[model samples]
Target: MEIREIFAHNLRALRKTKGLSQEELAHEAGLDRTYISSLERQIYGASIDVVDRIAKGLAVEAADLLRCPEAEATK
Candidate 1:
């Protein structure tokens, strides 16, 4: 998968695992709910700062959100 796709997939999984809706995550991250949805959909690229904010909101390391499953298989 593309890096953006990986980010989107991981983001969705993490959000679900945390039992948080997009709106809740957005609120926690101090971002707009629509922006969160757009990120989850891979409709836009996220800056490093935004990624950090998302990771903080999810209580996880930023790198965790960037992990790509396909890249792991190539390892």
Candidate 2:
């Protein structure tokens, strides 16, 4: 899958795992809720700064948001 898809998938999964709604995550990340929704839907690409902000919101490493789910399944 493409990197955008990977990021979207991981972002959604991590957000759910943390029991956070899109709005909640967006608030924590200091972003708009629609922007967070767009990212989760793969409608927009996140910049390095946005990724860092999101990672901080999720309390995870930025790399975690970019990890390929298929690769993880093989591990």
Top lDDT prediction, candidate number: 2
The 0-to-1 C-alpha lDDT of every candidate, in the order given, reads 0.93, 0.95
Residue-by-residue lDDT tens digits, candidate 2, 1-75: 999999999999999999999999999999999999999889988999999999999999999999899999999
| Residue 38 in candidate 1, Cα distance off native in Å | 0.5
Worst 10 residues of 2 by lDDT: 36-45
What is the C-alpha lDDT profile of model 1 across 1-75, one tens digit per residue?
A: 888899999899999999999999999999999999999899999998999999999999999999987777799
Error of 2 at 70 (Å): 0.5
